[model samples]
Target: MKSTYQTKDFWAGCVYVAIGLAAILIAQDYKMGTAARMGAGYFPRVLSGLLMLIGLASILRAFLQPGERVERIQLRPMLLIVGSTLIFAASVRYLGTVIAVPLMGLLAASASRMFRITVPALVGLALLTAFCTIVFQMGLGVPLPILGSLFGG
Candidate 1:
């Protein structure tokens, strides 16, 4: 008998399983009321159960279907993107959106091959910063400060 494999689907299924299990575990402490009187945990538990089922189906399909294998992961872009996100999360409170947004954009830009401190890049950064401000700050009413206490804004 020959063995069939689909690395992408298998890995995606594994990730879904992990996320579902984690959500289920975290929601265990909360009370799960009946379907009619839904508790805090009810929705999460139901969603997680669905996710688990989808993951199971995906895993089964990986073995049954003929699909491509997972491509090699790129470390540089991954690290830069992840690191920039961490920086944004950690510094958002201290640096505020006005400063943190541009910094995050620059870090993300550095991950790409066309990274340059050119006029176009600066314009793009400005546009991104404005969009973030309008969407997250003005539209969503997120309480993040535009300027931190250091700048006194």
Candidate 2:
């Protein structure tokens, strides 16, 4: 008796399909060489194809099985997570990864109803920032400053 449109799986599948299709369409303009010698669009096209397959499977499963209903959207958490990403992107150049990463993590974690500013959490954030800094800035030799331009680094 439940409508398929109200199922969580259905909605999730729809989102995946939309994103996959969009990626595939956008990648169409780029060259797609052989797998051994991949072109600019090769990875995107391949990944998008996989995503579409998964979405189709999900859609099929939604129709064949009873699934949980799509619940009301949680705007607070959604907004917090999205806002954190945007803030990180906007601030990284000026504030650098050392500060921006933890700031973004804290903002995103606050989206959880049970989030607390414990010492452990702070330590974890610090470790994460350090790891990202080493991996991205040092290991990979990314040009992003550790201290950033805002601090005259």
Candidate 1, 1-153: lDDT as tens digits? 033353778778888999999999999999999989999999999999999999988888788784668888999999999999999999887888888999998998899998879998899889988988899899999898888766776
Q: Which pairs clash in the backbone of model 2? A: none
lDDT of 2 by residue, 95-129 (tens): 98989999999999999989999999999999999
Superposition-based RMSD of candidate 2 using all C-alpha atoms, in angstroms: 6.1
Residue 106 in model 1: lDDT: 93
Scored by TM-score, the top model is 1
Instruction: Give candidate 1 regions above 4 Å deviation.
Output: 1-6, 88-105, 116-153
Q: Which candidate leads in lDDT?
A: 2
What is the Cα-based lDDT of residue 46 in candidate 1? 93
lDDT of all the models against the reference? 0.87, 0.93
Angstrom error of the Cα, residue 11, model 2: value is 9.0
lDDT of 1: 0.87
